[model samples]
Target chain A: MVWALALASLALVSPARQAGVMRGGAAAPSFVNAAVARAPRDGAPRVHMASCAKLTEAAALLDSVDVFIFDCDGVIWKGDSLIEGVPAVLDMLRKAGKRIFFVTNNSTKSRKGYVGKFTSLGLSVEPEEIFSSSFAAAAYMEQIKFKASGKKVYVVGEVGIQEELDLIGVPHIGGPADAGAQIELKNGGMVHHDPDVGAVIVGFDRYINYYKIQYAQLCINENPGCLFVATNLDAVTHLTDAQEWAGNGAMVGAIKGCTKREPVLVGKPSPLMIDYIVDKYKIASRNRICMVGDRLDTDILFGRDNGLRTCLTLSGVTTEAKLLSQENQIAPDYYVGSIAEFAGAGVKA
Target chain B: MVWALALASLALVSPARQAGVMRGGAAAPSFVNAAVARAPRDGAPRVHMASCAKLTEAAALLDSVDVFIFDCDGVIWKGDSLIEGVPAVLDMLRKAGKRIFFVTNNSTKSRKGYVGKFTSLGLSVEPEEIFSSSFAAAAYMEQIKFKASGKKVYVVGEVGIQEELDLIGVPHIGGPADAGAQIELKNGGMVHHDPDVGAVIVGFDRYINYYKIQYAQLCINENPGCLFVATNLDAVTHLTDAQEWAGNGAMVGAIKGCTKREPVLVGKPSPLMIDYIVDKYKIASRNRICMVGDRLDTDILFGRDNGLRTCLTLSGVTTEAKLLSQENQIAPDYYVGSIAEFAGAGVKA
Candidate 1:
């Protein structure tokens, strides 16, 4: 029934329908066994942050969430290094007996790379606890049973995607190596593509070239039942507090424009990440889980869309004014100036 | 008035208006200060290919086109080698005292590179007779007087774009060199953007990385009234009869998606190419010129939009069924099984 519905959604070329499935939202994210499970509350509450009363209310809300899902790049680290006060807050949270997961949309780093980074940052994180877009993408493929089933995957990313695919035992082609080492591109020449490729997975690739784009396009256009999947369609990546960089969306947009097809984004806001977490961990009650994130669209939307209680930390991307004025904006149940504030507001430092 | 119109169009946020100015079409391609000139006919009759009678009709129609505009790929050559009957046909047409122009949307090759290719193909052609999107892009920048005017161009393309910019004396940054050689993109660490940079020109960059896209986005976002220009938005490049590569549209689409702004495309179907041709050559009567190409949208649309006759050649991209069925499709004045077929039908071979 789900497969049939998915196929049906792909056929609707209307703009309204484009939002339903192409975004990885059509599938039920976390209601594992039953459709009758109550859906998560939408637009929960506005935790005004002007007074001590609101601060206590926000802390109480954070205290209730059994599992705390934190976003990486903006929340815990900036670029390759750890953010200040993040490690301390994380230690405090762990000591308070809360289950923690680091969810990030940055697909450039692999799980192994992330494991090393976590150790360096003085945080005890399990490989399973880190759910990056790269891993989620691989997990998604596995969920759909697209791993080494007489089909190869075409990658448009860096080492992260390759590492995840290797772990899943899925053979892949067309990535950074061929793109970066390319010396000459003849206007009209012998163009080659792997015919066995059945899926094109796009992530945050630094060496995103025309050759890769062409190869990916060929794989999708030539192959039947080829899946066009992207890690995340993030509009921008705040590499630091002062700078914004082009995210995976830029790379995906190029392929999207060329193929005139939408990709199944497997990152935050897609509900796919939460699905991966819930399915793997078998969370007893999802209602107790709270998602703490930096950005509204990816982190907050992921939490909201996946039926988890949401909290927005001003420590990252969202400003209070921008978060408040937008219509139908995903309102978090709690808001704090920073996650660092959590240490002082009733939580043991 | 032009700036007001440009701003108004930008505000419309409608797809139709996106074509008006963002594509460099708002500024007239070339009009020699004459409002009394006769416009070319639209939706003109196509020469039938049913029988010997239709063959003669096609031959007669070809006889009327004094100036022939030929699209390079698929028309003159299939890939790197020349197409079967193009050279002989060109020779015959030249002997018949016809003015010819080779126009292409491939921005990867410069006019000199095109000249070398033409020479190698045994065609005696002048550098000025060849009008590529690369040349047109440079000319457009030159027309706008970007060089030495306290402004620089940030290119998202390869050697062709650099060569053209070099010829026009336009100092450009963010091309192939800086991108392919980039290591460890330190997010938000001393990003050096030329403050005088006023235009971001996107062409076919095979080394299209996240770094380049980010720089291009920053150039446009940071600089006021920076021109967002693209060579062509051709969906696919026919590398050979059997293979298709991702075109400039993919690269341009990335920047457009990231920047959330439109680009001024100076290639076919945008009418800017023909405008450049008309203005530079100072054609007394546009009715005598004919645009011959394989694609309907780019080639036929270019001719139709610029008030010139158009012909479709089956040797390259379009199929008859697709050309006919598309709603409000750009129709041509003549159709042949191939440009080679024209030589066999009635024209000298």
Candidate 2:
């Protein structure tokens, strides 16, 4: 049950209004129509527009601004296309001198992929301004000063984690067969005695096998404090069509439960991740910054704790079905149809 | 580590003097000293006593008292041996006509075990007056109408769970290897499959095996709504001796992580568990309850959420080490050496 049900009541609107809004011609009716479509279904609980109103209220509460964060996939576009007038709205925000940073929990792709996404969406985004949990994991390794000199690191991730470690001059220890390599879980690996390996890094690896989980557990158990790092708390991964599948979060959750230790979550909600972003952007004040994401638990909670305004768009991750069931547990301040909805003139105030 | 350090500090004093004061008596000193000796040596930030003081102040601010709750184990004794003055304390409370109930998260042991312990300690206690997570799990299963009849139920627990199921008249399916019988995961089977089994019941099975886990997963995975139950959530269990080990909480946690479905928690701290206790005993009111336990995470959290005043004793699971750890999240209203210390007459309110 996506927020699409919210538009049920507004379904009575004239086809002209729906078309106008869909075409990005009218701002107010466009948002209203989208909200109506995304609201809860009839006979079910009506949509709580408090989240939509929360964004406005939260923005008003802020006295100053620092880093304006944007979650790419849901907020900017669905896939290959931009959401209505998102490009123009982003341009307007940039012209208004708002410092924006693209923040994503996705670790499968590197900065290059994010840059490519911006190019495809017709939004001007710099690679340097993009932050991924993969980057955070790499930064954590560096912060802790793990031995990375020609150290073989195993990878259970896509190019994102591999690239980050590469950029930092960490050698990729391919598999258990690569005897001298540092074992990276989430990739393919088996049990072996490698005294040369300094740490086992966990990242978003799509090709996760049972052997990887078993070997990873063995490594962590054998060498206590072998630097077990996780890319994000994303239990599920985003599909190309916007669906979610099991990801690193699920795998890490298994290990954490088994070990009875919460992983050093190096993702969107962790203070460490936010600190990295703030430091990278040199953001002095966090008062006016707004965090935009589809996840209420991680994104909204992060914003709420960090004193940043939060905007929850119904474009990804959480659906109305999830919201209705978990209303008390996971809640964001604001709701928006899409990033494009913010293009309206009233969005400024 | 354990409140033992504090107890040791006061151990040199006379027992009569100890009975006269709230803490710092000979008995209190011994209890605290024992705890300290058993606790980890590494110094960590302890939970501020001020928070406990604040909770006490909060209770003091309350206008009335209706019920009094008590925690088992450390508050009473370590296993069969009664804490120094627990018997006298209960007698006094009983004589005063104050309502009292034993609250414990020890799902490994049954209500009968607890009743027998009290009798051995020379204190009179009714089965109805005692509440354990094991009993709670059984009652919950019954309330939920878990196996009407001829239901081949898998039992992975001790005699308590078996007794509950038997009393409910639910036919027990033999072990996984037995024809038409589903071996309970807690008993010794990890993963088993039998077409005839109707449901899987999880309780505290000390000898949980890999096959049991795997079989439970298979049974649950095969049937989406197949009942998965847990006795309680005391992450770790404190033995009669000083050492602590992983309890049913960890096993439940494993199953939950694998299934992605939350288990129905039957044990203490659950509202349903609390209700079962209340109904069985027909407690008049809930106002004057004071719950005493060694752990704030389990017992104290239970008391806090359930409108009961909580006291933390330093004889079991929680040691001074945890108190010193900055990461330990929960706190209690009062910190005493033991129930014997609380039973003493001269402690200032």
Candidate 3:
């Protein structure tokens, strides 16, 4: 079978596998909470149940789990600051000697920035405790042994990516003038005007205009073998003012959705991030680990896809309404109104 | 039976005794055209082939079909005055004694503005030929006998909606504060502020800020019995710069999507417009009517849902890729490269 069950916590797995947990009861630890099927209505899309009890039950099963994974945006904070009681919850977790990690798919900020943010927000967090998609992307380039000593790779993202590439000593170029650099490279021809582009790496470039999208598409099309990497796969970025703007995820999706080729993801729930966290921390049994997040598509999905206990908070992206509607999607092992509730009540094993 | 085949057409008609026509066999004098299903695809949404094919073929069936319905924004000119041979096609149709009816769900522009736009585009059209959501909404108020004689009916749309209420002699209040003389009423007691508002009329408001949406929601929540009317149901609006902007449909959907109450639609394919057109023009039979448009959900669906022919054009919103993917949602009767092709090739009937 193309699908197989992993005998571990649902929180540490991939997003796709995490959504598949509602199938067999015998495979799981126990069927503590199950969503009920709703009756169909006339002229309305059929909706399925996503119960809060299911998340609570999952939390109960992974009481003393070791590792803790957290998503930054929509989980802890919308952008810049932390949600209510986030600092206190983290302090309690640290006091309890629980191993905590900040696993974010956002490729914009560097680890130092994340550490700075946490410190500024009155939370004790170190640079080593943070893991971003930019780090994973740079590592992928290193693993592939990509040659970029003299040639440039078009950078399309933020400071985190630039920092990662700088750490790896990789040279990259970007701009409207450098747009035709890829086509020039294909014909064994070096660009006479600005000839130094070897590959194209698409990241979250906030100041995106029409010329940028067109140039990026052209560059990628010209050089088929050129490296193309997308930092993360988030369609919309939630902000504080309830203003939702389309993120790089949608652009990446438009490009990858149009083109059938899957880009190598390097963020949380990609198995890459989980593996990095597990191996680096030397966390011995994967079953002892638990991942807490607010978004189902990213956080709970990351846990379920991996082998960690997944706890979903109602304070973020997927609300009670969204959860109640999502039937077969990622079901969290524990459902808490806020992270503070989990820390205070202590998940019972 | 709930679903049975008609003996004359062998077409599957619902138990409601909806009007249907016979397919190919004996050529009846009244027969305009026949609809057939396109080849099926795996993992595709299920669209009744007749639904997609009937509208396009309907154009050929009529003997001088009155009121040629054209969906605006996406179907005709999007954003600015940029369209692919639409103006020329309209000119040709007008010369051939076809009464061009600009039927749109867009409640942004007034009839005078639309008439002016046509004149500027070299297409001689009158204000009476335009049928917009505002006009349909006015008709609905009259039909429902909504009594709002001195009471303030909060208008959340453009000047066109205000103009429609003026024509119908409905005492209305509320417009942008910037319009000193036009400001008949202040913000009502809704999320935005205006209290004491009797009803809510949702129109195409481009200057929608957070305050506006909040106000609208607040108003609706305050008055459960307040009437909610949406001019159209378009998901995305295509702009001249090849950009997809949020149309009133999404806003309408957001309000409805957030609130469980569904708004009454006053635009095309709702049977209201078709009835108004037929009654106003005194069209002998519905069989002679054909709906020509670029979008599938609104334009083509109008024909399919109402037992008329629909023609899908590539010049507007629904492209070939969208058509192939949107098989399950809505389908057009005939696929044409552009209106130019449809107009150039005379109706075979």
TM-score on alpha carbons, each prediction: 0.76, 0.47, 0.57
Task: State which candidate has the highest lDDT.
Answer: 1
Query: Is candidate 2 or 3 superior in DockQ?
Result: 2
- Using lDDT, rank the candidates from best to worst: 1, 3, 2
Per-residue lDDT value at B232 in model 2 = 71
lDDT of 2 at A202: 62
Q: Give the alpha carbon lDDT tens digit for every residue of B1-349 in model 2.
A: 4444544433543342233233322334322222211233368434223234312222231223345577776677764556787777677666655567786766655678778868877888988777777677667767877655445666555566665566667766533232122223221222336655556666545444334544555566565457777777555554433323345554565456445667777666666755665567676554345666887767876765565555677877677657545445454545666665544441322
What's the residue-level lDDT of B22 in candidate 2? 34
Instruction: Spell out the clash pairs found in candidate 1.
Output: B22-B264
Q: Which stretches of candidate 2 lie over 4 Å from their true place?
A: A1-66, A77-84, A120-124, A148-152, A174-190, A240-243, A319-333, A346-349, B3-261, B264-349
**lDDT (tens digit, per residue) of candidate 3 on B14-34:** 221133332321233233234
Q: Write the per-residue lDDT of candidate 1 for residues B260-319, one digit (tens) a residue.
A: 788888889777777777788887777778888988878877875666766788778777
| Regions more than 4 Å wrong, model 3 | A1-63, A71-97, A104-110, A131-284, A294-307, A312-349, B1-67, B72-100, B105-107, B133-272, B275-284, B312-349
lDDT of 3 by residue, A42-115 (tens): 56555443323544343444355566777777667765556787776676666666788888877777787677
- Model 3 TM-score is 0.57
